[model samples]
Target chain A: MKNNIISSIRLTIVMLILFSGAYTLIVWASSQLTTSHGNGDVIYFKGKKFYSNLGQKFTNDRYFNSRPSAVEYNAASSAGSNKGPSNPAYLASVQARIDTFIAHNPKIKKSEIPSDLVTASGSGLDPHISVTSALIQINRISKVRGISENALTTLISKQTEKPMAGLFGPERIHVLKLNIELDKMQ
Target chain B: MNTEIIGVILSFLVVVILAKPMGRYMGKIFSDEKTNLDFLFDPLDKLIYKLGNIDFKKEMNWKQHIVVMLTINLVWFVLAMLVLTNMGNLALNPDGNPSMSLDLALNTAISFIANTNLQHYSGETGISYLGQLVLMLFQFISAGCGIAMAVIVVNAMKEKVAHTLGNFYYLFVRSCTRILLPFSILVAILLVLNGSPMTFEGKDTITTLQDESVQVSRGPAAAFIAIKHLGTNGGGFFGANSSHPLENPNYFTNTLEIITQMLIPLAFIFAIGYMLKRKNLAWMIFGVMTVGFLLLALPTIWNEMNGNPLIEKMGINQHGNMEGKEVRFGAAASAYWSIATTVISTGSVNAMHDSFMPLSGLFQMLGMMVNAFYGGCGVGFLNFYIYIILTVFISGLMVGRTPEFLGKKIEAKEMQIAMGVTLLHPLLILTGTAFASYAYTQNPIELSAWLNNPSFHGFSEMLYEFTSSSANNGSGFEGLGDNTPFWNIASGIVMLLARFIPIIGPVAIAGSLASKKYIPESAGTLKTDTITFGLMIFIVIVIVAALSFFPALSLGPIAEYLSM
Candidate 1:
């Protein structure tokens, strides 16, 4: 039993080392991920802090709106409240987001807001907003960049991933892609 | 689009078409129950025992046999690990696929040794030619080892004392030589005939249209691929995976691969039941497993069959949603491959699963939930024995009788072993997936930020993959660039542990039972016979799987469902 303990202990240590080593090697091999698409100036933001710089940095014309994100009272938190459309909290949150979105994009109609625009992602702090949301303000962004909303939306369509291998899920637009297209338009 | 569709069909056929003959041949080799093949190999067994001066015929009880097994199998494991670690130097010639890193080597070494072939690297570019033969060869051996252990345990449970607990050296040797080697040779040749390449050549260098010096991947792919499938250990030699024309090729080879993969495992079931003189039990086991496999798998095919909704709405119909799928075989073929390999612990992917629709993707994850239900080669059937024992135990408790499986009593100790075997890997998977999914939430990949809201869902799927991989069921539908160490090592270790630790439980129980006196198969023995026992066994398997993985499933697949 003592020998068994010793052998297993030695084995455990060896395994741990192997685990870390392999992981490190995998990490190293996957360094290609690090060298990909360069980072842009959309700083990670939280709660009301994000509202202060709304149009100052994220201009309606220059920056296409990504998904609306509230830090949800800023606790370093990130998860969808998991509330459904029927849930009051869900309704309240969606209403609040819609109000903010409408106020920000004055040129857009309240009816034009895509549901994904205001709805919190499963991860509430989703940095990306839906393409429809971006589309809601595409014309404004077009005015700033001197590109038509059609061209921008076309680019967004190209940038978007076809729903996870062609079928088995719903299609939605990506926020990061639209904003990047906005940057390229500039 | 055509490329993706054919690739899917080609791979799907590879699973179903190849599973039978190889399975039938393996069934005859492993069984103590007679076939002409066993008779021919009988002298070979005697030869090894005589030459080694060890009396294999010496009457030994179960405990002694298990101890011998522990030594032999464990020694093999260690030696295989050492060889894998040192394979870089051992290669006859260096191929484009370099030697695996230490973490990869260790994980891979143990994975093949345990007969759970979860790969972190692509066959063509990531692993060397030597690694394939040395590391991959071990999988075939370990699979045989699994059979040998089962044979020993089954014999130990027999009523009267036998002169032999099937000769380990003979069983292992004959298993590889008779069943695995011949089948692999025939299949490899057939694969080459079907256009799957089989050579020991290095990579072919090609000057691209742009005049770039790109080194195209080449190796003794078909040779190892033949064994890889026959052994039911599905690690692709290249990035194109089984979808690679050289590995799967046309529909003929595709069917051959599917048949071979299923044949080895299915035939073993026949072999085990026949050897135990319980052919009925064998069919029952197969029937129960097949029913569950179809239930989960059928939907996977149906759900993906019609094409992507987004594609329809957007009017992009040049091809069916062949996003991650191979066009050569199309939706039907890839969908079947997705279901079969996941259910069987074969992880070769023909389609990029990261792009599979939500439920189809979820079904793929669910296949791993019942992974032990129809796990890989040696591990899969032995796991069924534990499940069988457990079903008997639960039924006996309810029916007011001692739990006796095949007339051997299963008490508290056996229950402990069964529960451990059932639960240990799920814990690894659940916790690992939970941890990884949470990590994914923290770190999302920005694919031009095209990875919108569903990226987290992809992360959830990745968690499922790592869980599936580490747990020794190597099916991937969600696109995870697992060629990285984070995935490889984590998955590799999980694969190794999930594959081997469960065997320890079965072996220990077998040894313990071998020491006991066998009570006769009386009435009210809670018959492991009949469809009723099969149902009970199925229920126990389902319940344990549901309870262990359901919460995590709710977190990953369910979450993906709601998001989608």
Candidate 2:
């Protein structure tokens, strides 16, 4: 038993190095071949870097608003507003968001507002919103940026990502990338 | 079909196609048979054994195996504590995240070591890169430990019983090298190539297109995430877990993660058939588990797809329960993930359970409450075996015959252990929640922040924590503000007992069964592998889980649902 205990400790140490050290090193080496070079995909817009996959706050009138973030789009810590559906406070907050959305985009009706527009994502930094979510904000952004609605619509269509193999998952657009193109059009 | 429904079906079909070969391969590893990739693993394994000074040929009785497993797990616990608490000074602190507090460290260590991975602290700002690696180590070995113990139980079930089961070290090493490591590498490479980060760098400060500066946290996450799923250790590298875009980059990775997490638990079912040469029994168990799984999963998918009625009443075209869900996966896929992760004990969340529709939360909780549906890797089968034993005994009483399983008589001692193991699950979950409720009621002001949602939903948060802990299933409602000393220490104790007791109970039963004189099956003996017996096991599981947890369920999610 004593010998076994010693061996057990030794094995634990050896296995840790193999899994956590050597194994991670191999994966790291392989990451060097990827486009992001293992640091995560970065999109440099006007000399300012942004993680292409991570969400950013875009609440300015000139940019299409990203979804509401519980952490205010804090990339360092990801989380959700873990509010239950029946919680009165939570429901009221969603109502307030609905009111706020209607206030911002006066032409849009409350029924036209997709729930994703007002909801906080499970990851506070969700990069994409449904394609419908992107399109609804066009009226507000077009008025603010002085760009024609047709131009903004064309840009959103170009930035939209189809579901995998055109059948699985959801049709969505990267909010950061779409807004980046929106800014470049100016 | 809706794309959401199609995605859900595709994920399950992929797992079905993959389980057979993986199960066969795992069978070879466990039975000490040679395989095609063994040339690569054999030398690597030999070096491990030599360096660790392990006697690869030495066999151990069941008690020895338990003791050895615990001893090594202790080493891991200590290592985890040291690193987590001191990570502020550790070398890999590129983000300079401070070390964990003592209680949080204790909870984190126990959570990972037990393979429960109930995170009391968020991953990004909570621990350093070194701490992530240490927890990742536990992710690999703890799962290897579970698979090894399960193999021990399987060995004890052999018809021609041997005095000694295989060496714990040999089984442990082989489980890692032959089973976990190669598979993890495959997943890690896929994740890395598809844009999940895999670097030892600090967080990057990124200025948004809106000109807001936010620090984007990245690390050796792809490797961490790969084993996190493959080992069924669902401790995510980020607070939002797989919901984080980097942790699960896209729909393809989402499908891959769910499939990877569900694969091994199902594969182990097939492995049992291959090892025991009881393909009928394996199929029976598979049938029972799949039925239980779909019963939970299908409703959850339906619930999420129906959209939250409360939100719908707010004069909006609700896109299901998107409050705590991702757009890329949509409602059906996210709902599918919640049940799959819980049922398999992976606990990795692609969608936050707290924000799920009330009934959906109930289904998720029920999945954990009946943790044996497919369960975590090896331990899932162990939990299922307890139900099988109880079913055999109960049915024997009905037929007025001796309860014999696989030619071994199920005596009072084995029955006692089985009953005890079955009772422990509910006792731990209920008592822990009851205590927390008492404490909260006593000092509502002091513990006001313990719950994120009020009234019935708050009660569900507390109930879900203990349930997740006791089941060793780790996924939580997350709305529970659970980082307090009360939560950390309470759930820590629950996770420790929950993990070892179930394992010890089954191994002990299997060991005892192996030593008894074999009684040949006769017409009077019950056939455990038949569909009728599978029905009996399912009935027993439902009755046991329902009886124990129904009241708690009513108070928590069910009440919340009705109120809504």
> How would you class the docking of model 2?
high
Best by DockQ: 2
Q: Write model 1 residue lDDT over A1-186, tens digit each, in one string.
A: 343234333432332232223222332233223321111012222111121101111324356654443323121122223222122343455566667766666787665654445433322223333345556776776776788868877887776544334632223344444454455555
Q: Tell me the alpha-carbon RMSD of every candidate.
A: 13.7, 1.1
Across residues B231-265, which tens digit of lDDT does each residue of candidate 2 receive? 99899999999999999989999999999999999
Q: Which ranges of candidate 1 are over 4 A from the true structure? A: A1-186, B1-55, B58-91, B94-97, B161-164, B207-214, B318-320, B438-454, B481-489
List model 2 lDDT by residue over A1-186, tens digit each: 688679988998899889989999999999998778899988786778778878888787777888899999998889999998988888888899889888889999888889898999999988888888888899998888888999889998999998899888778998888887877797
Highest TM-score scorer:
2
Over 4 Å off in model 2, which ranges?
none
| Clash pairs, model 2 backbone | none
lDDT of 1 at B11: 45
